[model samples]
Target: MGHDKSGINNELFFGEKNAFSKKYEAILYNESKALSPSAKVYFNQINAFLAMKKGKADLAYTHMQRIRVLYSWYPEIKENNYNEYLRSNRNLCIVLMHQKRFEEATEVIDQLQKP
Candidate 1:
C-alpha cells in the first residue's frame, strides 16, 4: 500500500477489522526472521498503522516508540527520503493526543517541529 499524506496506507494495510492486525503480525514476524533492521522498522510502522486503525491507542504508542528507536540508530534511514517518517511521527502525535497522553504527544510534536 502506498502512503497517503498522513503517511499511512490509503487502503487498509492488512484488511478490514481485525484482519489487518493478523496479517500485519504475520508479515512482521516473517520479516523479522531475516534480521533486516530496515525491514523490521518498516513493518513496525505497518503494525502501528494497524493498531491505530483498530483504536488500540496503547499498542499504537508502543509501535511508534519502536519506530523512534529504530530511527535513532539507522544511518541509512537518515540518508533516505524521510518524508514518510515525518508524516508517521505527526500521525503518532495525533493518536497520542486522542488518547489524552498530552505530555507524550507534546514531546512528539516538539520533535517534529525541530529542524
Candidate 2:
C-alpha cells in the first residue's frame, strides 16, 4: 500500500495509548514492509515517529535525514509522495528545535515556505 493507504492513520486515530508502547507501531509498519518492500519509504516516517515519541530527537532527526537521502535517490518518490515528504520535514524541524539546532530548524522552515 502507498502512504495514503497505510495503517498508520488507523493506529494513530484508534489505537489505545498503552498499545503504542514497546515500538508497537514500528513493528506493525515493519510487518507491512515484509509484505511489500515498496513500503520502505513509509518506514522513514515510522522510525521518526517512534524516535520522537521516545523523546530521542536526535534519532528522529537522523531518520528524517535518511529520508532526505532516499528522496534524493528517488526524485519520483519525492514528487509522487510530496505530502509524506512535507510531514517528514515538519518532523525534522520539530526534532531540530528539540535538539537546540535553531538555525537548522529555521532553514527547514524556510525550505518549507518555498513552492
Candidate 3:
C-alpha cells in the first residue's frame, strides 16, 4: 500500500487501543519484499510506534533494530552510515527509558552526540 493508503496516521490518531494494531502490524511485516526498502523502513517504524503505544518496549526495540540494519547498508557501496537511523536510535532510547533501563537509555542517547 502506498503512503496515502497506509492508514498509519489514522491509526495513530483516531484508532482506539486494541488487539487489531498487532494484526495490522503483522500484515505490513508479511508484505512481499517487492515493497521498496524505504517503505519497509517506514512500516517497521510504524510497528515500533504501535508497539510502544501498547507498552511493548521489547518488541519496539526489535523493530528499531531492523530499521537500523537496513539504514546501515549502502545500496551501491558498503558503508555503515549509522546516523541514517538516528530516529530509530531516538525511539530506542524512548523504549529503553520506558522499560526503566536508565543507563542503557543514556547510552542510546549518547549516540545522538556523535559528530
Candidate 4:
C-alpha cells in the first residue's frame, strides 16, 4: 500500500464499527481469554500502518521491527506464519525506503529472498 494522504484519510473511520484503531486494538488485547502471540504480532503490524497514517514514520518503523522480535518468541512462528513474516518484512522495507535508507531496505529484500 502506498503512503498517500488520501489513502490514510480513507482508512480512518469517523463513526461506529471500530471508531479508532486503538479502540479495536484494546478489544483485541483484553477481550480474549488468552491473547495469542500471533495476535500480538498482528497488532504491531496494524499499529505500524496506523502510525504511518498519523505521520509517525519513526514509530511505524519501530512497530514493524517489533514484529520480528515477536515471531522469535515461538520458533515455529516464522515457518507457520510465513506469509505474514514476508508482509512485515516488506512493510519494514517500505518504511526504510521512505526514510532514504536504501541499503537497509536492500538488506531486508536480500533476507526475504533467501531459501
Candidate 5:
C-alpha cells in the first residue's frame, strides 16, 4: 500500500473526478457504520492516507493516531500487530517530516526498520 496506487485507477481520486477523495470518503464514513469497531479502523487508515495525499499532514496524523485507540477497542487487535506498526510509523514519519522534525522523523523511519 505504498500510495502511488496506479492499480486503484477506478477510484475517483485519479481522473477528472479528482475532487472525489472527499466524495468517496463520505462513502467510507457511511460504510464504517456497518463495520465492527475492529473493521472500522480501516476508515481511519483510509482517511489518513487521503489527508497525506492532500497535504494535510496534521489531520493525517490525527487519523493515524486514532488507530491506537481503535486497536485497543478490542482485545482481538493484539498488542502490536505488524501492519499496525507499519501503518502508524509510516504515517507518523510523514507527519514528522512535514513539521520539519527531521531528527524525529528519522528516528521513526529507523524504528520502522526494526525487527
Candidate 6:
C-alpha cells in the first residue's frame, strides 16, 4: 500500500519532535552542496526552528541571519506569500523574545503587521 498522508500528518502533529530531523538534515545537507538558493532559505528556517526548540538562542539567531541575508536580496517577500512569511516571522520573533532580544522581536512583529 502507498504511504498514508494522514498518518504522516498525525506523526508530524503529535509524535516525537525529532521524528523528521534526519530527513530534514539530509535534505538540508544535500541542498547545501547544490547551493539551491530557495532551498537554502528553507534549510536555514528549519535549522533556526530546531535551535529554538533546543533552547539554543545564539544558534537560532545565526540561522535567522541566513534568512535575513536571503530576504535582503528580495524585499518583496511580503507580496509573495504574506501568510507564510508572517508565520515564519512570528516564530522567529518568539525565539528572539525567548532570548530577550525584545527590540528585534518587536521589529519582526511590526513588519508582519504591515500591509
Clashing pairs in 5: none
lDDT of each: 0.73, 0.70, 0.67, 0.75, 0.67, 0.68
Better of 1 and 4 by TM-score: 4
5 or 6: which has the higher TM-score? 6
TM-scores of the candidates in the order shown: 0.69, 0.65, 0.62, 0.73, 0.60, 0.64
What is candidate 5's local distance difference test score? 0.67
Q: How many clashing pairs in candidate 6?
A: 0
For model 1 the local lDDT of residue 34 reads: 37
Clashes of 1: 0
14-56: candidate 5 lDDT, tens digit per residue: 4436786556656666535637765567777777777777678
- Of 3 and 5, the candidate ahead on TM-score is 3
Q: Which lDDT value does model 1 have at 89? A: 83
Looking at candidate 6, the ten consecutive residues that score lowest on lDDT are 9-18
Report the number of the highest-lDDT candidate.
Answer: 4
TM-score of 2: 0.65
What residue pairs are clashing in model 2? none
The all-Cα superposition gives candidate 6 an RMSD in Å to the true structure of: 6.1
How displaced is residue 70 in candidate 1, in Å? 0.3
- Which 10-residue window in model 4 sums to the lowest lDDT? 9-18
lDDT of 4: 0.75
| Tens digits of lDDT, candidate 6, 2-59 | 2266555533543344567555566655435536555677788777876765668898
72 Cα displacement, candidate 5 (Å)? 3.2
- Looking at candidate 2, the ten consecutive residues that score lowest on lDDT are 29-38
